[model samples]
Target: MNKNFTLFNVLPLVIGWIGIKYGINWLTIIATTVIVSRSIMSLILSAKLHSSLSHLSETVRSRYRAVLRNPQLTFSVAIINMISLALWGQEESLIILAIATGAYFSVRHQLLRKT
Candidate 1:
């Protein structure tokens, strides 16, 4: 996996580890859920819209990139991840979290318009 993506995936875990070490009730779990969920959403959106990405369409990629920058979008994804993690149990939660985290970094690499 890409180093950046791996870092993104581990972001929440790192925070959680820190909290665990310090004995704090940090929202790292919640944060992880959000980050992962947002990534899944962006990926789904990109796949739906990137019908011709094989040819390299900057426009579609740009739109998805904008989605990445949206706090609201990220928040929603995080919320969904949290709820899903709560109900689906640990394994599913971990998988989704991983996807979300990995995708978080992928978004930067896949930025459409390029900043």
Candidate 2:
């Protein structure tokens, strides 16, 4: 079997197993996984960048940190998830959307304050 093909199949297989075992919706599981993974990757990349730029001024470093922590991707994913859930008649979508939006604004506010 091709390695790429095997890797692709593994995700769905694991997702399916998790959904079945936990009795959770597949879409919810996928969205949660993507969101968490994105966050972790962002944090790791930001930390690496911060360390590499240790000689930079605090203002510059802080701004870069804020930019890296921006929640645009997370907000986009949450919006899509909200729409999907709403279309499926799930009431929890509103709460998820609200949280994502709130986080985005909160971070933006802090960034603006720093600037």
Worst 10 residues of 1 by lDDT: 84-93
Best by TM-score: 2
In candidate 2, what are the lDDT values of residues 1-115, reduced to their tens digit? 4564344334434553566567777655574455444444445554554355536677876765566475565456456545544544455535644554555455445444543
For candidate 1, list the clashing residue pairs, or say none: 34-78, 36-100
- The TM-score obtained by model 2 is 0.39
Note each model's CA RMSD in angstroms: 10.1, 8.9
- Candidate 2 Cα deviation (angstroms), residue 62: 2.1
Report the lDDT tens digits of candidate 1 across residue range 44-106: 764544444456456756676665665554445455545544543434555655555455445
lDDT of 2 at 22: 75
